[model samples]
Target: MTFTAAALIAASIAPSISNAAVKSEGMKVSMQLAPTADARQQVLTQSAVQFSKEMRRLWIEHILWTGSYIVSAISGLEDQQQVLSRLLRNQQDIGNLFKPYYGDAVGNQLTTLLQQHIMLAGKVVDAAKAGNTADLNKYNAEWHKNADDIARFLAAANPSWGFKWLQDMLYTHLKLITDQVVARLKKDWEGDIHAIDQNEAHMLQFADVLSDGIVKQFPKQFQQ
Candidate 1:
């Protein structure tokens, strides 16, 4: 069984939302997109697939949140950094797990984003260790800018997956960075907050779940 792209995207972009929760929706759609399997096997098999150009695109989409995470940390508006740290670490771990799936082009992009994130994170950690507010702010600003560019590039290069997926998932994350997150950040900057948060995180989880579903259904296609 295989899912349609629209159903899969809906499931992936807004699982928490009503459209996604329909038992016959995403899972039904899953049959059309992939095969229906238990969640445990789904996780195990998808984990086995090597990263590919498609996966790399997905990775970049995930990493785009690095900006929001950094800003959240810098402003001390949220206490999710520890969770975010785990997420980042998991992404790094997954990158290694996925290295075998990517071609040279995809691998290079993955490597580039990973390096930038590491360097940026390191600087932030170092600033915190040294208690340098100025440095932290500087790096946080850079993180925001870099994240914006990365997100834009991702959308431009792969609009189908990037913006389409993002817009669909937007509903999940919009609640987190609502007036509160924006107001706080807005005080400092005279522009958009790019306030992606818990909802966005939830959407990413859906994407991961769907990707895993695809891999489980078509191991050979993904395994390389």
Candidate 2:
């Protein structure tokens, strides 16, 4: 994002004076004011820190709710739908975070993609539960494709976020999620816990990357 430098000027001019005994004199004064570079940088640093924290919080919520939904769905728990609803809402929350930087349309597009990701994950879980290899494979492939689309969309918006890097991160995210599902199905509690721990750490890193990219892309917004 680019910012136009605007000068705020205040000026005053003394009234003209005419007199035979005194020399006429005129005075003009003007001043332009703006924040100092150091002040601006301080504000930018604060904003970046806040953004990083918020992103980490949101992404961490994403993984936690998702894990809850996975456990509920696999175990045929009564609160599965409620957990799923909360998990889906996290996707919109993440998208809303982008609106200030990317506008409503772009934010909504991301929400759609993330919603699709969640829905595809549901299908994969169902297929796995039902022992349907064909549907599981199909939905898993589509899930990966959705991840690719998300990576492409973000990379197009900010060059600081490299496509290959984002893609790899998203792929790893998917693998961790799959590991959780597989471990749960196999009744390996320790493995499931490990995957959950890894997923949370991975998503925190992902959130940091996203925050850094946004800070780079729109430096002016973060300035004083």
- The top-ranked prediction according to TM-score is 2
Candidate 2, residue 159: the lDDT equals: 69
By lDDT, the best candidate is: 2
Model 2 scores worst on lDDT over the 10 consecutive residues at: 4-13
- Tens digits of lDDT, candidate 1, 77-187: 465566466546645554444444444555456446655654565464445434455675576455434444444544454322344343333322322222223333334
Q: Compared with the true structure, what per-residue lDDT tens digits does model 2 show for residues 38-73?
A: 321333478788888999999999999999999998
Error of 2 at 8 (Å): 67
Going through the candidates in order, what is the number of backbone clashes in each? 12, 0
Shift of residue 177 alpha carbon in model 2, Å: 0.2
Model 2, C-alpha of 26: deviation from truth (Å): 79
